[model samples]
Target chain A: MLDAFSRAVVSADASTAPIGDLSALKAFVASGNRRLDAVNAIASNASCMVSDAIAGMICENQGLIQAGGNCYPNRRMAACLRDGEIVLRYVSYALLAGDASVLDDRCLNGLKETYAALGVPATSTVRAVQIMKAQAAAHIQDDPSEARAGARLRKMGSPVVNDRCASLVAEASSYFDRVISALG
Target chain B: MKSVVTTVIAAADAAGRFPSTSDLESVQGSLQRAAARMEAAEKLSGNLDNVAKEAYDACIAKYPYLNNAGEANSSETFKTKCMRDVKHYLRLISYSLVVGGTGPLDEWGIAGQREVYRALNLPTGPYVAALSFARNRGCAPRDMSAQALTEYNALVDYVINSLS
Candidate 1:
């Protein structure tokens, strides 16, 4: 049950270690990373875990943005867009590492929607959003017009806009707030 | 302003708890939930950015008789700029969390939370637990529902008073 804060206290406790092993945390962090990677290996599929973790952090911030009123539109959009990138990048890394279960379908959709809002080019960016959209769109669009596959292609190939981005931001905010209030 | 102050005070009075990775995970989970809800709120019949936006917009749009105003700007250039940045930093935390990664997400959580305190003209001390609580709940004192928020609000008051 040694939480991060308690570990800090335990390390700082003069009675226990004489000199605090501040560097111990670095090792602990490395271990945590390994554990995370191991967990991914066991899961086999990229679990939405990382995305879920980061998603919560984003929601907390969005509530504050809404509170600040609409003064910094450019920064606001930029901030949301940037966050979207971070989440997308993290998901990409997890996926590349062979953890497909790290993100759920809806969240995967979120990544796609967010990247689309940024007007990101499909083949250029290393972002998972770009890769997924490009590959998926090409696969879907190749199907015949009257076929059900084409309809599915149309659903997946649609452009995502800033409005959707805003909606995501708002959703993350509410979800985070409620979870926090309930977790205690 | 009153609700904010009240919440801050209530938070300040709560017994502090050392944070753990689980706490961080819990914090992260809660925030993600909040983000999802925020998106849903945006899609709802009414356009509200959580409870505050609902209140702010309602007070602004339908209430034609009311005047919505911002904080007064200082006459001194340096002071004004500093104040603005401080508030921006606070707002940035909220926005960054909501939108995604903030530029300063690299800062450790406690330090990052402390940055908010500094911006708010509060002193930094051994209030990691308190700060965590505040962040987990957000800065809106009125929006708080649980006992943690009450205690967190008290802690905020104590910190603010201790500094002043």
Candidate 2:
């Protein structure tokens, strides 16, 4: 699922490589912009893999905040999904914009809000957003090749899935596990 | 929770006191624990967590930058250029090694070499200074600047030339 989104992100960006003369390259890039636009649309739809993954994990945990077999909001498990959706949307937009530099201020701000709302630690979450932004900035000087950009998007997704976003998922699941076991 | 958080922050700060290896080793234990707790609790709120998370997120988000050998290649080129300058500068001052005739080469006689080495030494002092400052100030050495490298280069010249 994540792999598909990764491919979509990479394929969406126009290549910065010089294929012929300067004019030809620009023309190629201009023409490719439409393709990139299409890719962004595809990316928005495809990135649901992240949310789905988190949701499934929560379900597997017996619904941490379950009320009648469904996880209730405000519970740790539900909070994780909420946070995941927030981050996923932000990340998807950033990727769709085809510019990672735009992520720091906007994305980080949203992350801070989510953490505050979920009663989770905002420290790592904020740092994760900042790190994500810095990562994007570092790539500003890079050539906009689909392969290169896609590789970066994919790499960036790990922190979302494993560290920041996924970390929340795992944490919620663990708490649910503990509560369920303790209750049993 | 606050106590654990405080300890972790202090440990992270203190870890900056030693050399890179020790600093990292010292912090890793506390940091890992703190990180785990934050992950487990899903309730982290502190400046330290903020900064660490920022760095972590930045690292994760920018993972692609690290994968690109091209950036590394460019940085290496920059490093090579700087080193080349150092070598050239070093050779220019090797004349001092020959000037060693009586009581430590004086400023009046071998002043040019002395000055060159002194210029070089200025940079060297900071690398040493930066490490010391990082220890005292409690931070990472890489947080120091390239100016430190340049300073170290100068200090090497000063020590070499002064050795007679």
TM-score of each: 0.22, 0.23
lDDT of 2 by residue, A1-184 (tens): 1111122222322241111112322232233323232223323333343344454455445534456332355565465555444443434333322233223443353544554575554333333333323332222212224664575443222121112322222322332232223222
- lDDT of model 2, residue A104: 40
Weakest 10 consecutive residues of candidate 2 chain A by summed lDDT: A1-10
Would you give me the overall lDDT of model 1?
A: 0.32
DockQ of each: 0.01, 0.01
For model 1, how does the per-residue alpha-carbon lDDT over A1-184 read when each residue is reduced to its tens digit?
Answer: 1223232333433232212233443333333333232222212222232333234444444432344422135675455445444444333322221222223332343544554676533222223233323332232232224464464432323433423223223322333232222212
Candidate 2: CAPRI quality band: incorrect
Ten-residue stretch with the least lDDT total in model 2 chain B: B95-104
Fraction of the reference Cα-Cα interface contacts (below 8 Å) that each candidate reproduces: 0.00, 0.00
Quote the positional error of residue A88 for candidate 1 in Å. 15
lDDT of 2 at A32: 30
